[model samples]
Target: MTERHNAFFTDIAEATRLTQAGRLGEATALIQRSLGGANLSAEGARPTDASPAPHGTPRLEGPATRLDPEVDAAQATLIPERLRENIDHVMQGLRSLVPSLNGLTGGGQQAPGPNGTEPDGVASEGGQFVERSFSNAAGARDYKLFIPSPRSGPRPLLVMLHGCSQSPEDFAAGTRMNTLAEEEGVYVAYPRQTSRANAQKCWNWFEPGDQGREMGEAGIVAGLVRAICAEHSIDRSRIYIAGLSAGGAAAANIARAYPDLFAGLGVHSGLAAGCARDLSSALSAMRVGAPGAAEPGGAAGFGAGAVTQKLRVPTIVFHGEGDGTVHPRNADAVLAQAGIEALTPRQEGGINGRHSYTRTRYADDAGRIQVEAWSVQGAGHAWCGGSSAGSYTDPNGPDASRAMLDFFLSHSLTGGQG
Candidate 1:
C-alpha cells in the first residue's frame, strides 16, 4: 500500500484492534501516525487550535477527552474534556502505571504481553538499547545491545550473559557492567538465557549435549555471537565473554566451542569442563565444578582430561575462598589447565586476605595466554567488589570489573601472535 493509505489503514486497524485487545497506548501511537500522515489534528477528525490557549485559560471539549492544567493557578479551570477522557481511557487500557506499586493495590497492572514483549513487539528505547531476536530450528532467543552515543571507532564488545531465573535488565543491574561500559569506550551486549532449556533457567552447560561444534546450547550461543557481530561493527578480535554461575559456565562453553570467536573468557564462580561427560557426570561436574580432569565435560568413556588444551586467549579468573556453591579449587585447576601460571599477589593485606594478580605470557613466545587470579579472603560466591543493589555481591575484594576490562583492552588479535 502507498504510505498515505498505509497510515490510514494502520490507524483504522489499530483503533479497532487495540481497543478490542485492550491496548490503548499502541492504538494511540497508530492514531498519531495517521494524523501525522494525513496532516490532521492528533485526535484524527477532531481538531484543536495550533496555538496555546490564553495564559489564564484552560480549554475544554465535550465527553470525548479532557485536559486540565497541572499547575497551582489552574485548579479551577477545566481542560480539554474530550482529550482528557481519551487520555484516561488510553492510559487505563495501556496499563501504564505510576512508577512503583507502593500505592497501587493488588500489585501493579499486567504488562502488555508475556514478559512485557508486546505482541506488536514495540518497546521504548532509551539508550543504545537495541532489541533484536534470533531463531533457528532448535529455538529462539532475544537480546539487547547498549551502545554509547556518537559511536567512536570500532569498539570492544563484551557479551554479558544472565544467570538462571533472570532477565537482561536483572543481570545488567546486578553486574553494573553497563556503568563501567559507559565509563570505558566499549560496547556491551546482554544475551538472555531462556527458561525452556532448564526449569531453573540455568544455561545447560553441564549437559554432554551442550558442548562441542554447532550443536545444542553451544550452537545457540554461537549463533547469537555471530548475529551480534554481523549487525554491529564489533571488533572481532576484541570480543570477550563473561557470565555468573550458570551463565559463567555457558561463557566457558562459548570459549571452548568457538575459540576463534572470543579473545578471552571470564568465569565467575563457575564450572569448567569434564563435569558433564554423561548424565551422571554432568550432574556431578556441574555441582562439584570442573577442573584438573581432561575432557572436563563429555561422555564417560569419551577420554579423560581437561578441555582447555590450547592457549586460545588470555583469561582472568575470579573466585571467593569461602564460596559454597562452586569450590575455589575449581578456579585453581582452571588456571593450571589454561596454562596461566600465577605471579606474586598484589596488595597483601585486606578484608579477605587481599590479592590482585599479574600474569606472564602463556608459552615461551610472547603475547600468548596471560592469566590473573583474584583470591578474595573470606569472600563468598559473589561479584568481587559488587554494589549493594544486587545479590551474590561483595565489595571487599579486588575489583573484578576493572581487572577484566584491563586484560581485555591490553590484548589484540594480531599483536598476540608474536
Candidate 2:
C-alpha cells in the first residue's frame, strides 16, 4: 500500500515531466484524472499506509471526520514551539492596552503537594487565582475564583461583583480586595457581566423581572457562587456578597432572593430595591441626587415598600454624602426600605482621612442582623478606597475593603439547602 501511494505521486511527477517536454495536452488530461483518482483512493486508505485496493475487494475504510486543513496544519506544524513564545509576546503587547492584569504586585506560588498526591495537578497554589465557566437554565457564564493560601478547614466565601465598565481584573486591581482575602484566609469570587447585555456591563437590577430567585442577572451571580462553593473549601454560614454601583444593586437582588446563600451584603454608592422598574428607572434612581433616596418607593410600590422577608442578610452601605449621581439621601431610603434605622457615628483615620459611620441593626425571628451606612464627606460616586489609576474611583474615601471584611466575618448565614 505504501508503495502504491508513493507510485501515485511518482506518476503525477512523470505527468509534469511530459507537460514540460511539449506533451501539454496529454499531461493536462492525465493530471486531472489522476488527481481525482488519488483523492478518491486516499479517502479509504489508512493514514499510516496509503495503500491501494486489490481486484474485487473494496478498500478498507476508517471513520471520516471533517476538519479544517489550515487549522490542522497550523497546530501540527506551527503551534508547539511558538505557542509559549507567541503568548508571551502577545501578553506583553496587551499589557499596554490592558494594564490592570499587570498592575497587581503580590502573588506567589505555594509548594507543590508532595509528589503529585492530589489530582488535577494540584501544583503550587499560585495567588489563589482560578477561573472556569458554568451553564445554568439561562446560559453559560465565566467566573473567576480566588482561594486564600493554607486552607485548613472550610472558609467563608466572598463574592465580589464588579461595577459598570469594569472587568474582573479591573475590580481586583481597583479594590485591592485580594489583599484582604489573603489576610482573612477566605475565598473570593468575581462574576463578570457581559457587555452584550448592557453596553456599560451593568447588572440589570432595576427591573422586578431580574430580581427573583436565580432567574436573570441574580441567577447568574448565584450560579457562580454555587460553583465556587462546590469546588473549594467554602463556609456556608459565612457566605457574603458585595458590589459597587450597578453591581451593588445586583447584590441586593441576590441577597433578597437567596438570603440563605449570603450572610451579608456590602454596597457602595448603589441603588436599593424597588426604585427601578427598568433601565430608565434604574438610571434615574441612581442619578436623582436626593438625600434619603433609598427609602423604598417614591413611585408607589416601586422600591419603597420593604419585602416581608426583611432582607435577612446584614448590610453595610458606603455612600459619599457629596455624590452627585446617587445622593446620600438615597442611602437613607435604602435603610428605610430594608427596615433598618441609623445607629451612632464613629470616627477612624488611616490611609486617607478620618471616616464617620452610622450603623443599623435588624433582627428577624432568628436573631440580630446588622446594617451600617458609611457616609464619607466630599467623596463622589466612586469606590471609597480604589486606586487612582482607574476612573470614577477615589483612593481617599473610607477603606471599604477592610470594613466589608470585618462586617462579613461577624455575621452568619442560616440556610444552604439552595
Q: Local distance difference test, per candidate? A: 0.57, 0.59
Q: Pick the candidate with the highest TM-score.
A: 1
Off by over 4 Å in 2: 1-126, 289-300, 303-309, 342-369, 414-418
Q: Tens digits of per-residue lDDT for model 1 on 193-254?
A: 54334544566666655666576667766787777778677788888888877677667767
Q: Best candidate, lDDT-wise?
A: 2
TM-score of each: 0.64, 0.63
Pick out the ten consecutive residues of candidate 1 with the lowest summed lDDT. Answer: 60-69
Write candidate 2's Cα lDDT for 209-274 as tens digits. Answer: 567785666776787788777877788898999988778877877887788788888888876655
In angstroms, give how far residue 121 of model 2 lies from its true place.
26
lDDT of 1: 0.57
